[model samples]
Target chain A: MPEHAILREVGLRDGIQMAARFLPTERKREWALRLKEAGLREIELTSFVPAKVVPQFADADALAAALPELSGVTASALVPNLKGAERALAAGFTHVNYVLSISEAHSRSNVRRSTDEAIAEFERIVALKRTQDGRGLVLGVGLATSFGCTLQGHVDPDRVFEVAAKVAEGGADELIVADTVGYGNPAQVKTLLPTILAIAGERRVVCHFHDTRGLGLANVAAALDAGVRAFDSSLAGLGGCPFAPGATGNINTEDAAFMLDSMGFATGIDIPALLALRRDVEGWLGDERYSGAIARAGLPKTYATAPRTAAAPALAS
Target chain B: MPEHAILREVGLRDGIQMAARFLPTERKREWALRLKEAGLREIELTSFVPAKVVPQFADADALAAALPELSGVTASALVPNLKGAERALAAGFTHVNYVLSISEAHSRSNVRRSTDEAIAEFERIVALKRTQDGRGLVLGVGLATSFGCTLQGHVDPDRVFEVAAKVAEGGADELIVADTVGYGNPAQVKTLLPTILAIAGERRVVCHFHDTRGLGLANVAAALDAGVRAFDSSLAGLGGCPFAPGATGNINTEDAAFMLDSMGFATGIDIPALLALRRDVEGWLGDERYSGAIARAGLPKTYATAPRTAAAPALAS
Candidate 1:
């Protein structure tokens, strides 16, 4: 059987970033705590960006204040630049995730920098994390547009490998491969993930995929079959890119958890609890175009009885 | 590398069966032909059932009359009993699909028969297929709720295997394992599909899966990796079970074909033409809540340059 997978909740950071309105600081804290209580060991609680640029994380400091109350949770926040990394450390986040796009056009349009410039920023953030105040901070790197880009179309695997090797050599504590524009497929995920893992050596890796083309869960399955054990998902499938108009966002946390648990990976998620939280979150973020399947179909009748293990015959081969 | 997979369009039959309103006969014929024009070789054109029961396929005869004009296309019709199969053969359908639920509860509620009775009915149908009028007809059997059932929940694999063995031995030309309510996951699929193939021996097999829990394409990927080809999909992911409310239907025909093509399988689907037809179909089926990723995100940037094949390492192993 495959190992237990970590499903890090990103609804607060990624999902909220695309929402039309900002959730209150306290509500964000409460929701994060609820997610942790519902068996998430890690949570990407918020992002450190200029409030004027993205108003959703305007109260990042206030939201990060209650991280200590999360008990055994490993909380991380997104930092767009070195200054944002500084803000993240100052706000009591011991882990920070820095994102960089691989596609030149996506880098220019999304982060207002070229791909090379984004890599340089990542190196700078690594240096900043080595400073006194940033000591003990685990700096993870996210490779946006690692799979495909809306602006650049198909991203070459050779180029992606080059960037991944750079991140792996640049001292990222973990590597995150993201399908930033939801243009990924199962064949790509199964083929590319092992190469990314080989580049990372011993560093842990996670994938961030979108449901823009409805292949999110299928890609997750491919990754698992490829030996991936960690994933990033949002509650209620709550996130979308500002650039990809009419596109949906990440795979649902509850739905992915259900898939993971059903596949016998031991995600330790409480389906009923997660579904209840999803309902509350839906009410909180009224009319935000929520997505998920288990929330809609209810849990499978055999959910508790027969969680099939991967130790079954070599069926995929 | 994996071989080319067959994608059989089920929108006209399964999709319309679930629609609140019946599609006009000429429009149904036009849509099926348009589907064929977009490179679809097989289509479940319609179902042979009483108009008083379904109302959507009430014009089954009218729709079947145009099958000859399809030229080289292979057309199949769904049948609930031997009588329906007889109707299908009389109406120029060279292929007929017989559906049976493994879940006794589902069988009772769906077709008003027990599981044993359903198997017995399959035997009777096989006898009828050997008769003079049905001599050259191909009798395909669909194992409904083979994965799980909304009524019974978590269908037993042993029971499904027994039914599959009987069907294969009783002369089923094709075996279609169906996730009637979408309670299937990738692991369950990868494990079960190979066993189904083992029971099938030399017979061809297809899968009819719903996206109720968003794992439709994932199941497809698993089945592909398991060496099974041919799937039943509906346009824009249409079709649903009345038993499972809030459940969406099959994987999108265009999206599944796109994934198959991108995965280096020569499905021969013309994405642009299919998308155009989908737009027209969407306009025809207003308020129907269509589902698919390719429709919203469009095609990828690398669609023309690169299509990844399965030979790229043992990623899924």
Candidate 2:
């Protein structure tokens, strides 16, 4: 049996945030169902934020309501703060990822709060998750700009370690170290991940990499070597950090999954199905830029996509 | 001092081969100089093929003669057989890489000969290289389609080991495992490279990967992990395999350099200069499809391109 590696799709939330036109709620739902069918066992479907901030993820509640239809799929939404997490819990979300940028400037610019304030909010959310109504909610925190921040220039690894220590101790179930600016190199990932993982201790360490400088997949490969088993990816490499101008696409979901699958890691992703979804999404999100290689070149002739019925996402080699 | 890793520019040969319009000889000289000025110590300037076959390389002699101007740069060209190599030797090339496909079908389609015939030709070239004039020449065998092929699909690992053993014993000075069809995965690279390296023993093993399926740099990272110190890259990712339909770009020279630079590898590549070269090459080759990330995203604010004055390209960490 191959070792499991979870690649959760963030196209609906992270990817679509960049799309100019608002995709109808039905379209987002359709895409979500297609992603689930395409063997994406875990999908981050929406972000709970005001429509004024990001109109694309305005359908967060609506998408959250459709989670029941996505049986067998581990669905998640991104929540900005205590209020957002509370809303997600009220909307019946089983999982919500709270995002906090490690960079002081990025944190203020992105969520209109300081890094310490966000940390306080995260603690509040964790406390909220312990309440009667939030009993079943899984709270995950994404440390945005963990690798480096455009606003702050080089983000110190000590800062990342400091944040991870705080978040892990705050009772977070999982921590996602993000290369929000796409400034991360494989060496940085290799050097920093061990420390971040060490700080997280028993908590799961997931990585979110942007393909900004084209090292996204490479960083993922390094993280895999560092014992990380889960990743956050956007479809067709959609989504860019608005904070980092000229930065485009998250580490592409299809590309990341294809890479993992080809590496003999059990991703349980149907690449053909995922590519088909990419084509549809491209048509749907007409103006948004897409970045990836497999869709353009197509899968190699030797590829055998793992069946979705695989018990877990794991490594074969 | 960081350990040395060489990133040889193949954009002039591998990249421009895909260009529809012929670039002037002067333009080629200018780009080659620019590449060297950007601190790429090695550059695969052209291929020694008959002009009747690839008119793009018709000026091979002119470019080879111009090599004298590229002082301090280790330039090479591709030779199909002993005759082309003799032409290169006569033309003053100190290095020539011989092309051979691991896939039998690809070998026939690409070089118009059986794999064994090509091997025989390779042996003939090695014999010729050992003589008085060829003494100074460095011989490298690029086993194309070693990963997977568009024509024959998966090229067996045992077959790769066999070819490496034969080439190493047959007097080749260097071995390049090329993912010609862009079918290589990191797992496959990490798996195959150890054996290939073992077979090579004292001889160096370089990697030439096509970004056909987007895992180029990831594979580079894997090869680096397996102890490969040199790689072949194209400016702006300008090349593609003729046999692989829809394939675009060898790994982008600038992207690969940037990746290595970020990983703290001593590539001695001036990425800002490389990006400037990419812009010029992009303008020169108007229609050739380009693939890469850093060029589009620009280098991060924290990036400090290696000083061209550096003595070697090696790992710093």
Docking class of 2: medium
lDDT of 2 by residue, A42-90 (tens): 8898888887898887778877778888989988889998888888888
Q: Each prediction's DockQ?
A: 0.58, 0.73
Model 1, which residues run further than 4 Å from truth?
Answer: A132-135, A305-317, B133-135, B305-317
- Give per-model TM-scores: 0.94, 0.97
User: lDDT of each model, Cα atoms only?
Assistant: 0.85, 0.86
DockQ, prediction 2: 0.73
lDDT by residue (B55-95, candidate 2, tens digit) is 99999998876888987888889998899999998898888
* Alpha carbon deviation, residue A129, candidate 2 (Å): 0.9
Which has the greatest TM-score? 2
**Which structure among the candidates has the greatest lDDT?**
2
**Cand. 1 Cα-lDDT:** 0.85
Candidate topping DockQ? 2
